[model samples]
Target: MVLIIFFTSLAGNALMICLIHWDHRLHMPMYFLLSQLSLLDMLLISTMIPKMAADYLTGKKSTSFIGCGLQIFFFLTLGGGECFLLAAMSYDCYVAVCHPLKYSVLMSWPLCLRMTLGSWLLGAADGLMQAVATLTFPFCGRREIYHFFCEAPTVLHLACDNTSLFEYLMYICCVLMLLFRFALILTSYGLILATVLCMPSTDAHQKAIATCSSHLAVVSLHYGTVIFMYVRPKTYKTTNYDKAVSAFYSILTPHAEHPHLQSEE
Candidate 1:
């Protein structure tokens, strides 16, 4: 599973990057955003999976304080970045389908670059905040982490004091990271679906539906696991159930970015 996850995500993201670079036709706002998503997913999974592989093979299930802190930081950073990038992709789809004529004007290369940069900056800020907040909590010398890798929720579970402040910050970040983008993706697709059905030509409608549908599919899969993982009130200390879900997003979500980009061809 480790070898599979590493090579597949690496190849998948690498291919998406290659496609955007070599194919001039893909040098547009949509594919550009995809390239960013690919890059972010690669980084996101890389933060968790390599450590997990080593732990599985070596039977070394423990991470040092520094290692755990850094892992949580990078995981949140990349994951948050992808959240914003996906939202950007959804909006690009919205404009391309619902405002085809203005897509060129509205989503120019400069604007797209700016949006991507903004997503990265925001993600970094959130990651830094959450990392500090989480790690500062008193752990009461508990060292064994039940999850496969360090995560905000898993890490916070080890805290010995009232985590109300950290939990509030976490909920706010989750709302911004998942729900905000979710609402945008849903609104874009709603308008997209209505517009596509009203189009006069079958071919034109089909093409628009295909594009919007791909983005919607990704949104559902990515956010479904994300909201399930984070947005709820903390429940169990650790469960195979949570680990399985986290593993899916960590392993497969990056893989999904590649085929979706390929389908555009």
Candidate 2:
């Protein structure tokens, strides 16, 4: 199952990148954000899946201290980047649909490049903070992480010191990514819904609604799972059930979006 998920995510994201690269028509702001989304997913799934699969199969779950730290950093970076990318994509959709004439100027290549660069920088900052907070705690020789991956909550539990600061910081980061951005996405789509409804023809309204619905579905899949995963208290421990939930969003949703990407193309 792990191998299947890894390869499928790899292929699906890679396909989106290639299609956008090869097709001139798909080289717009939306597709550019999508290719970055694909890239992030590839980096994200690669960070944990291979080691996780090996651990599960070989029963060697021991991870080096430095390895765990890097894992947490990369995971948080990509995860946060994914959140910002989705928000940017939502705004792109809003601009394209709400103000079609100005979209070319507003979401031009330069603006798109800036947005993508900003997303990565913001994500890296978040990750660096969390990594520093996480590693600063005394582990007291604890090393076993309950979940398949080295998640924030799981790692924090190993710390022997007061985790209040790290936990609070994590909650803030979670709110920024999953909650705040989700609301922004919903707001963007709400405007899209209203705009599409005001279309002169029912066919146009339906077509616009269909497109917005697809993006909303992907957004919901991501934010819903991540919110559930991260919004818990600091003392939260990982269960196999939690790992399963993480696996669902991490492995399944991007592949599901493959069909939508193809249809849009």
lDDT tens string, model 1, 54-91?
88899978888888888888988888888888888888
Candidate lDDT scores, in order, read 0.79, 0.79
Task: Tell me the spans in candidate 2 whose CA falls farther than 4 Å from its real position.
Answer: 234-238, 255-265
lDDT of 1 at 170: 75
Task: Please give the lDDT score at residue 102 for candidate 2.
Answer: 78
Question: How big is the positional error of residue 121 in model 2, measured in Å on the Cα after superposition?
Answer: 0.8
Model 1: ten consecutive residues of lowest lDDT: 256-265
Q: Model 2 residue 129 lDDT? A: 84
Per-candidate TM equals 0.91, 0.90
lDDT tens digits, residues 1-265, model 2? Answer: 6798789889888988999999998877777888898899999999988898888889988888788889889988988888898888888878777777777888899989998999999889888788877888888875776787887777887888898876887788677667788889999988988887777876666666655667778888888888878887645634776787777777676532412121221
